[model samples]
Target: MDLFGCMNVKGRSGTKSQSVKFFILGEEFNDDAKKVEVYKKSIDLIKHGSPRGVITPIFVTYCSRFSRMIVCYPYFDESLSDWLKRYKGGSSNLPYEIRIMIRNLLAAIEHQDINRLEDISPIVCVKSKRDNTMEVKVILLPVQSEQSSKAKWRTSFSSLLRKNMHQTWLEDKDFEAFLLMLESNEYTLENLMGHPVLQDGDSNGRLILDCFRETLTPAQHKELEEKLNVQKYDGGDWRLRLQGKTPLENMSKRSTAYPGHDFLWFARKTVAHFNENDAKFKNATVNRVPAANVIKDLYPGFISDLYKLSLEPQYLNRALG
Candidate 1:
């Protein structure tokens, strides 16, 4: 019989490990049957989850009627083309509000180093079905070319050790750039290890090139710093400007900070990550955590407090309090 579903059975040793074989929907499979891996990637990514970003609901998981794994995604509510059509064929003299939204979206994409314009689309504006406030959203899809995804996005020591593996196709320079991204804390290394890959791994890995595309040569770094008189903004200054809205403010900060002398520290780190040798890259990567930690670190009791702090009376009270 064909396999339909399975469940994990823990061991009696009190430690959590799969020790019992799972039947397909409580039915046994033939001894010589071939098992298929379905939604292998989507399943793994759902487990690892994504980082804090301007994007949301990157993808969702579902099981099809036939009991096969399926990957589902939110529909693109509105494309850039749809918005431009409203202005009579992308002509100038666009509405001021629409212009600002477009500007902010472009800034976000640039800060994220996205290439294709289609990757971004405006999500439909809607009332918070629950709270009744206007909300805006956008989508930034990641690159998914087979060669790029396998060679540059995901890799492990075992994969690297394999002869004539997919990763072997990467050019020496591209490979070096990939390793540099991992070393610099720009890309978390934990995802490259065993178990479920990072939910945002492919996109983040793809963007690493954008982050490392140009390194600040010493002369360039010095010249920029001299121009700025070596000034800098700390968390306090950012907090005031951001007004406690960390996520929204961080995106703006990333865009304006780039190509500025005061942000040389970020640039220098990129240079350091790019120049590190393989040994150091691997060593430093060992201590890193995935991007999901960014959310948890910001709100320790997030899951438990989400509804309590977000829903009706609580949210209203806190805001008015």
Candidate 2:
């Protein structure tokens, strides 16, 4: 079972949702006993039910079929992607100050590590949104080698943890990045003008490298940033101004985000239990959430269900193994 898509979510009890729609689903490829075991293991991994929903793995369910897991996501007005396209990608382009604003927003994510601060990978897919710009969420999707019906995208931790677990986790890498992002003091890319977001219209990505050399620490900037500036990938258009390797692609301008779907990877990691648990099957990963929280919107219950199914460790382990 896998996430089908998002839907119109409604109502919640206090902070709890009344009817949350999750798209993650389950499938019939493995033994029932094995499936149950993996499901239980993952549930044990999750300790807290995120309050602010910042670095927490949201686990509310909307109801799903036997084949998959169900989740409930909030419905926001728009996505960060669309917002960027409209506000930044459009003719207006992003102002240097605005870029700082956005970069600051993304930088904030580096600090929060949900599990292990050192272990947290980059936040995955991002989308555009409306309403409150500050509300924009940097979606963290799962990283996986294969796709399946049980949690088409991936599964949920809430489902796994809900069953039974004695231990409790106070902080994780996701929370680490979340805190860093939230507490970021280095707003400047080089302290000169921040990370050189507003590039010359004719320039490639490399120019940013020089800026980083002056601004960011050796660790803050990635090798890809420099390499990409000099090279072009399958989908990248060197001629046209780039937007830091399409939201989904990895280090390549030409490739699409996450290769499968824009937000799929983000959904997978943040919500996926099996994928994250399996070190062997690494999910497509990005560096971190954009300072702007790029993507924001309610994920459909169908998609939530898929995540539940995907989180089932036994099924996913078999697939990955």
Candidate 3:
């Protein structure tokens, strides 16, 4: 099918810092040539040069020798930022269409992860030319290549994770479980946090964690193998594709199984920590609005920590005993 898009050029664009210009073949395009090449290679590497379980946007280079480049996608009625601003609660309770876009985007990411390809672009939402539909499209843009070392990339990854408050849905226990899953990949719980506990002052340790985080497990590693295969990429609903595919439920079970524990003991500790912090703020002489604001700010981190603790059997066993 011939994919088409408009040239009206409406709405806000990404910042200059987040964008780059590229020279493809002999023509200039406003993107990175390397990213375009990588994306082209990814397309060729997939099952049929067109992956299923996701709708990848078509990139049209307007020349035999890649002289010009334009990403052909349907016109999106709203940017994710604008949509989130209008919708109040962000991705937590996104409208159906937007949710589909985000899900598809993540599915694309999963495809890249599954293929073990690096330097792929995150998906963007756009209005489709095919029946004016809103869809997620992956645009190949150059990522900053200055982070040449594993440590540098790991630091960047953790910092990004910490800033994305929406990831609170993972919960602290789930976060830790996910970490454990990644352990076979050589990542530790600390690799995902900006300022991991205890080892805060050790740059060398952070570097080591970063290097570990990028290490991929052998394909023969069964446990890690299963989690990485969570979605089958059969071109179905992204949510359905992820349902029960991984052993996420197993993690939840392990998290709640501390000796003589009914409820997850570590989960309770996280709640206590939040309450304690809130109490401290309330008792302070600060204005009620600011105090409340502070609690709100701190609450998500506590939740994240609580989720992380779920993966720590040693800590749970020690504390519950």
Winner by lDDT: 3
Ranking by lDDT: 3, 1, 2
The prediction achieving the highest TM-score against the true structure is 3
Error of 1 at 83 (Å): 4.4
Per-model TM-score versus the true fold: 0.23, 0.29, 0.34
- Candidate 1 residues lying further than 4 Å off, grouped into runs, are 1-53, 66-80, 83-91, 110-115, 118-137, 146-321
- Model 2: ten consecutive residues of lowest lDDT: 291-300
Q: Per-residue lDDT of 238-311 in model 2, one digit per residue for the tens?
A: 22322443433322333344332213333333323222334332332223322111111121122212222323
What tens digits encode model 3's per-residue C-alpha lDDT throughout 1-321? 112334433336533221212223223333476547645643544433334324333343444343444444333343344443454443221244533443343344434432212322333356555787656444433222232344443344333333432443234433333333333334443433322221121332222222212122333123222322212322332223224523222223444444332122322332233334565533432233222222213222322243234335653343333
Give the alpha carbon lDDT tens digit for every residue of 134-176 in model 1. Answer: 3334433222223322223223222321222123223222233
Ranking by TM-score: 3, 2, 1
Error of 1 at 244 (Å): 48
Report the candidate with higher lDDT, 1 versus 3: 3
How many backbone clashes does every candidate have?
A: 0, 116, 12
The Cα error of candidate 3 at residue 62, in Å, is 1.7
